[model samples]
Target: MKKNKLEVIPLIDDFSQWLAEADKSDNTIKTYRAVLNQFHEWLLSEGMDLNHLKKKDVQQYITYLESQNKSLATVEKAFATISMFARFLKKLDVVQDIKRKQKDKKNQEAPDSLTLDECNHLLAEVKKRRQPS
Candidate 1:
């Protein structure tokens, strides 16, 4: 689909203007525009666009970001940009139900404890270092 078909680019431009008027930094405006552009491309690839945006669509986009191995911070930034855009369009409902995905327990788990042999080696080192104590 042509980028203009969804009219997203214009909205993004307008949104950037709004951000600037609201005293947003140049870097902040650039970041938000880049994120919205990326989201627009994703929507086009999915055979949809912002005009058809829905909560499920936003959720699926989040899933897509995770699938692409994007860092959690990147995904959250994208979500935040989209949310702000939705608010700009007076369509907050499109993303209101979406929630950021945290790393699963398996991903968040601490590193495995030291092995028994390693533990014994550490103890031996400590004992050797103990001078008259």
Candidate 2:
């Protein structure tokens, strides 16, 4: 009998499993999986092997996501998930520190934006309260 083999993408599932076994909540695991799945999709498009990934690759991906108008926090979260996955694979320092854009040079207020998930949850709550049925 022939068996199917999975490469890096399937690792998202493995990492999710690890997170579950580590007692992470379902919501947390779901968020991690979504973030990692996006990264895996990017890797597939780039045709790069996980074993040969470098810090620059991580930076480029972040840049690509940002170019698409993604918020800084989302980019940061992607970096974080990739870094954690790298650590799980024993690939230390594969991700680099992404610098904040200097849009507000006058007074640098640290980023304090809610993630997409939080925004959606808030909207859902607002909708629930609006419907008095």
Candidate 3:
């Protein structure tokens, strides 16, 4: 009888293993997995290999996220997920650390503010709570 050879496993398999061992919340794990799958799909669409990914590739993904009208916080979360995945790959000796570009502030608009009276009332309440008799 001939012995059968096992086929090479995918990077995602390793990622799933690591995610299982990680001490993270269920929501966090789900979000990370979703972001990773998005990255995997983007890689497939672009004919790119996981081991050969570059910072520019990450930038392109960021641009794609922006084009889809994703909020800055959501984009940041996706970037953080990718960064974590990269670290996992590094630990597995699959690839070196690839530095992603800092996000551009062009899409970040200032948040709306409360009225002066509302701010003053909030501050007064805080002061009252902190004051010693």
Candidate 4:
């Protein structure tokens, strides 16, 4: 009997096995698997497949994570998982030149501000604090 093979969307189990063979800790393998599963789901929503992953898709994912207000550490970890998966899929050679970098607040845009009413109330409080007793 022959086992079924999927050309598209590489199996997470296979990747997990590869990671284990590479001496990655069980916790690391589990974390990578979870991250990959999330990426797979995001790809499905975006009408993409892992077999056809591209640099832009990865960037878009990072943007999506940021939009969802995911912590920087979470985003970086996800990127690392994707980078490792790209290396694992060397034959396909997708997601080239995606380098991880230290996140800088100066490079990032300012976060969205509160609504007008909230800002006004905050200003009023600041003004009250400025007054002496």
Per-residue C-alpha lDDT of model 4 across residues 1-133, encoded as one tens digit per residue: 2122344435778888899999999999999988998988788778776766788889889889888989889989998899898888773345565544467868789888899999999999999999999
**Residue runs of model 2 more than 4 Å from their true location after superposition:** 1-6, 98-133
What is candidate 4's CA lDDT for residue 16?
Answer: 88
**Candidate 1 residue-pair clash tally:** 0
Tell me the TM-score of each prediction against the true structure. 0.71, 0.65, 0.59, 0.65
Off by over 4 Å in 4: 1-10, 91-102, 105-133
Mind giving the per-residue lDDT tens digits that candidate 1 earns over 12-79?
Answer: 78899998998999999999998888888888888878766789889999999989999989999999
Candidate 2 worst ten-residue window by lDDT: 1-10
lDDT of 3 by residue, 1-133 (tens): 2111121135656776787788777787778877777776776577664556677677778778878888878788878887787788674232234333456777587878999999999999999999998
- Candidate 2 clashing pairs, residues 3+ apart or interchain: none
Candidate 2 lDDT tens digits, 18-90: 8888898999888888887777667657766555677777877888988898887888788778887787777
Error of 2 at 77 (Å): 1.4
After TM-score superposition, the amount by which residue 25's alpha carbon in candidate 1 deviates from its true location, in angstroms, is 0.5
- Evaluation by lDDT, superior candidate among 1 and 3: 1
What is the Cα-based lDDT of residue 78 in candidate 4? 94
Error of 1 at 28 (Å): 0.3
Worst 10 residues of 1 by lDDT: 1-10
